[model samples]
Target: MDLGIAGLRVVVTAGASGIGLEIARAFAKEGARVVVCDVDAPALDALDSGLAGHVCDVSDRAAVDRFMHAALADLGGLDVLVNNAGIAGPTGRVDQIAPEDWDRTLAVDITGHFNVTRLAVPALKASANPSIIGLSSAAGRFGFPLRSPYAASKWAVVGFIKSLAMELGEFGIRANAILPGAVDGPRIRSVFEHKARERNQSVEEVQAQVLATTSLKRLIPPQHLATVAVFLASPLGASISGQAISVDGDTQMLV
Candidate 1:
């Protein structure tokens, strides 16, 4: 099927590894000109051929503008912006969370979304088909006790997308969010590691507990999420606007 995304100029933040890298790969495979940005220089260096990337700290607004402008210039024009850069801040109850951790989480997971989108909106408006894709989490739709900060950051992303969708719809642009659960990765393992240490359980125990909630009983592949993202950016997904779709394996039973 023609996704109508071939030859489109696209930017994917945090495309060095994990889900972000998978998203970038999907677009590259579909023949789109992909520009990736990430803090991991080594990962950027290891990207597949034809994929251009730059070292960028999404937390830094100045670096974001410079990277986006350079990449856009190289790609000729930008039509899709994937705000996939994020961090899982320290796990703790609201009362136990430190102010510093909260601020850092908000900066990258939330403000980083704003920084890139704020810079990319102009180019998006100019495109015939413009789309903004955010990688939110199932936590974005609900609250979990030990993840107040991370939950807040993801929730903020949903609000950001909804408001931006309304404001940019006049300019023929669409915004959407993907909420995934337990995507198999080392980063996810770290999330459980922290939890295990905090709650006095082995990492195996935490992983088992979380996996039990998923009806599918397996880890979600980044490729699955990447496929969905590609569809959203294509003409096939023109009507999928301002919606947060869950990519979880029934891990989150959203209302």
Candidate 2:
């Protein structure tokens, strides 16, 4: 099916690696001009030659605004914004987490979404069809041990998109959230190792325990999440707004 994203200008945050990189590649495949910004300059340069990239730290407001302007200027205008940059901060009990860790995680995960959306709102509104897709997680839908900060930040992302849907709807702008389950990626592996060490268990043991809770009994790939993202940005998804859809392989039932 033609997603109708051809020639459209799309911006994806944290597009250096993992799901972000896959999403950028998928957008390029759909014939949309993709602008990917990440702090990892080397990684960004390594992406497919067609991708337009910039060195950006989403947590920094000034840098984010500059990147947004550059993306808009380069793309000539913006039609879609993917607020995908986020961090799963130091994993630990709520009381064990440092103040700085909490602040830093929240800054990048939640506030960064706000920063990019705020700068791109006018451009999105000006487009004939505009959309915003936020990358939340299964943790956003449910509580878990040793992931307090991550859960909090992801939950806030959901709130941000829902509120934006209400405010942007009248202007023909759509906002939605994609919540993925335990995706198999470097970041998640790192988190698993951290959890194993923290909990005095083997890495395999912890991983097995986590997978057992999911209905799919396996990890999700970045491409799996990217496909949904592409759809949300496409003209076919114009009627989808304020919805929190999952790519979790049916991990948990939602109301």
Best by lDDT: 1
Off by over 4 Å in 2: 253-255
What RMSD, rounded to one decimal, does every model reach? 1.8, 2.0
lDDT of 1 by residue, 128-235 (tens): 989999999999988867788888999999999999899999998999999998899999888888888977999988888888888897779989999999999999
Model 1, residue 204: distance off in Å is: 2.7
**How many clashing pairs per prediction, in order?**
0, 0
For model 2, residues 39-120, the per-residue Cα lDDT tens digits are 9988987989899899999999999979998999999889999999998787778999999999999999999999999999
For model 2 the local lDDT of residue 33 reads 94
* Candidate 2: C-alpha lDDT: 0.90
How many times do residue backbones clash in model 1? 0
